[model samples]
Target: MTKLFCILDGHSTPFSVVVSPDDTVDDLKKAIKKEKEPEFDYIPADKLNLWHVSIVIGDDEDEKTITLSEHPDAKKLHATSEISEVFGSAPAKKTIHVIVQRPSQGSSAGTSSQVNSK
Candidate 1:
């Protein structure tokens, strides 16, 4: 099993999960949700978006930068794909490799409730 460090988008701290190379991205999502617990209980695993990113440290010592949707290298992993297929046969350890993004609120139909008044 390999430990993958993942940071939730918009949050600085990262969490880690140990998974096998054969595990699919969907499996990882489930694991992430389990690890995150109450903080993410309302969000389904399938609704979370995972991005492979390379974090760059800015010139300022306190600043860490990451580009997801806007960056070309940020590859969005498919739910069905195996960990090995995406991270290569041997993946690195002790580093943040995945960025977790929650589904945008109200992005899905029927997600938002509107009150119609007379």
Candidate 2:
């Protein structure tokens, strides 16, 4: 499983979710909704689009956005993009986990470091 301490709050929400290597960004969004957990009800995955996704590797949160859908699936997107490749297989059980935060403005440009332990 591809573990990530997802900073699922970009639009005034905060939460985490587990995903697999074969899962697409779209699926990731759907998951936030499909899980049916009220805790993350604010993250409505039904409308998760490419623009809603942001990725950061290691200590970088550059607010970069990629066309994940263009690659067909998450695997392909991971292979083609450096950001996806790095975080695609981050180690688990680390005391200092990563906070993969989505852009807060539906479009953001800050990479400020944030703590996301899992």
Candidate 3:
């Protein structure tokens, strides 16, 4: 297991979350909820916009949008371009920065009803 340092919404400071390379985005969300649910007592964990959240690494210009089941090795590759910057390259555990993002205009817009009755 690697301890990933992350910054989440409603958090005042960075925190470490231990996870395995096999874990998925949903797994990470659950870990985040475990730490944040208490502070955001009124909001249900399911309503936290987990689907719209993004896990980022490094700077925005080089940032990548990771999939729900992307492994740590794959995410690390997406985060950095150097061949030496692979996961577990050093003594420190890998970390990922988290950010809340709005879904693309066309992503979920099709879910709405468009009545054509004239």
Candidate 4:
């Protein structure tokens, strides 16, 4: 099984989840939704975007907190991909490897017209 520490995007605290090598990324998402419970009650498992990332201390010397790496955009994990294939066969330990990004509530679909008013 693979143990991954995931944190909600924009939040610092990390949570843990375990999955078998046979599990898919979608399976991981479902597990995260279950782990988060009421916070994700309104959100579907498929809506939760998972990013394969590493945690690093912020540049600010005074603020000693971990933040997600600059890999979110390029590291979005695909739902159908197998966990093992994506993460390799090694078991993770004490490392925050995934970043969970909740879906945005607001849509920019209808805002395009406003920008085109110029």
The candidate maximizing lDDT is 1
Q: lDDT per model, in order?
A: 0.77, 0.42, 0.42, 0.76
Shift in Å, residue 75, candidate 4: 0.3
Give the better candidate number (1 or 3) by lDDT. 1
Number of the top-ranking candidate, with TM-score as the measure? 1
Clashes of each: 0, 2, 0, 0
C-alpha lDDT of candidate 4 relative to the true structure: 0.76
**Per-prediction TM-score, please?**
0.77, 0.37, 0.40, 0.75
Q: Candidate 2: deviation at residue 17, Å?
A: 1.6
RMSD of 2: 12.3
lDDT of 4 by residue, 67-101 (tens): 44545343889999999988888845556788888
Name the weakest run of 10 consecutive residues (lDDT summed) in model 3: 76-85
The 10 consecutive residues of candidate 2 with the worst lDDT sum are 71-80
TM-score: which is higher, 2 or 3?
3
lDDT score, candidate 3: 0.42
* Candidate 4 structure, TM-score to reference: 0.75
Report the lDDT of model 2 for residue 80: 27
Candidate 3 lDDT, 6-116, residue by residue in tens: 554333345665656555555555566676656544333334333222244444423343443443332321221221223343324333444322234455423335469
User: Which pairs clash (backbone N, Cα, C closer than 3 Å) in model 1?
Assistant: none
